[model samples]
Target: MESTSPMRLSFEIRQMSPQQKLPSPDVGGMSRSARVMALLGLQYTRPFHRDALFLFFFALGPAVWLSMTVLFALQPSPRHALWSPVFLSVALWQPLCEELLFRGLIQGHLLESMPKQKTWLGLSISNLLTSCLFSLAHLANHSVSWSLLVFLPSLCFGFMRDRFGSVYPSILLHVFYNGGYFLLIGSATR
Candidate 1:
């Protein structure tokens, strides 16, 4: 008796061949920065995205320091008086720019070039280098002590970016962390 199932008794096969060339996606329409950011967004995983976000807060650190210095210089009579608006600006703008540059651009590129296991090392080195650059960028502000404190958090942000594979959370954590510092120190200073 013959089976009536859809199984075939004989099969035909064809030779496999690889394509000589692969087509590249069209990106000519996108602006350089836009294209780069889009690539970063895609390449980074959820955790890294979070980390990028956290790193964003570090951007505010220098700004906060500068604003405070300016206010203090202008009116040493009431140190705490300028906290209101500065605090809000730090909470808002710092994270946005920091994430854009550090986690989104810098770490994103590092992760692309290095192997997964080495991501931590890459992130650490990159974070240190960039953080130093970041700190130095504020040379005009000229507070070694503040820069040192900022460095610590920047390292934490780098670790966060490596562990999570995203910058979003990093920016959030950054904003909160720096904001807390601002509130605490500003309140105490006042």
Candidate 2:
């Protein structure tokens, strides 16, 4: 009276919608290591396009530097030292690594379970949570105030990651922000 063949079961699974086929990785269905690998392997490249959001972030870099100058008495340091290893690390290395870890892995993993709805000023809950962790990570090498300031930019990076479905844009923005921030604010690392 009932069909229990493997073919029938496979057909039934095929009939289900994508959303119904399996649980999200963060929904306790996947092992921790498997989830980490899946998230890390998520799309890291998207066709480059200067969309409005990208333009907004690009312009915000200068504005941020100016605000730091006026608000925190941050002096613009000499650009002659721009070729130093520390400058290279902040501008290039750190952005790539941070974006890969935070946006590519952590936020991507969170998005699997969290609703995509914009909860805070167009940011998803995943972005907010990732930003908090990002800021906390900065506290190891930065002052409390400096670390807190990292939260906003972390949100921006996460937003770009979600919007583009890739980590490339986030990395670019991170580099732009860090290079300018260190150049203007003198890398106030503790």
Candidate 3:
């Protein structure tokens, strides 16, 4: 029988037996908005731990910045600061959409559908794929360097999603990353 109950979804990657597959999300009875959100990887039912979130902001953020800076020598040099409301869109709104779509929906779907195979140390093949796609998606606006550079942060976002069992922390990290980078640019250039 087909089930139509609106049920919760998990964004975390679970360790499963070799031949085992993940269960599909329960979206039958869900509201249209919820179903849409679920399809995009925004599972509201998952838990969000404080430790994970704090790590994303404080510990992981600076660590990532420093590492990327050393690896790519990235310097945020903004031409000028826009005091208008659009800054929020660049820093928060756009990042929210990106994290929801990339880490939340696309990566979340990969986690659900693909077999969880350890690619390296602890990175899953699905996560590696998602990060590749996420980085590739940035090819147009950013320079080739930046496009390739994005993979690192994208992977971090995926890690946050998996660690926290939800995309909320990833979303916040995205916001923190974008906002801080742009702010640095504005302050440095102006």
Give the whole-model CA lDDT for all candidates, comma-separated: 0.52, 0.70, 0.63
Q: List the residue pairs that clash in candidate 3.
A: 40-105
For TM-score, the strongest prediction is: 2
TM-scores for all candidates: the values are: 0.52, 0.71, 0.67
Higher-lDDT candidate among 2 and 3? 2
| Candidate 1 residue-wise lDDT at 155 | 69
- Select the stronger candidate by lDDT from 1 and 3: 3
Please give the range of 10 consecutive residues that has the lowest summed lDDT in model 1.
Answer: 16-25
Once model 3 is optimally superposed onto the true structure by TM-score, how far is the C-alpha of residue 129 displaced, in angstroms?
0.9
User: Candidate 3, 85: how far from true, in Å?
Assistant: 3.9
Candidates 1 and 2, the one with greater lDDT: 2
Model 2 TM-score? 0.71
Residue 179, model 3, lDDT: 70
Ranking by TM-score: 2, 3, 1
Clashes of each: 28, 0, 1
Which residues of candidate 3, in runs, are more than 4 Å off?
A: 1-35, 45-49, 52-57, 63-83, 115-119, 187-190
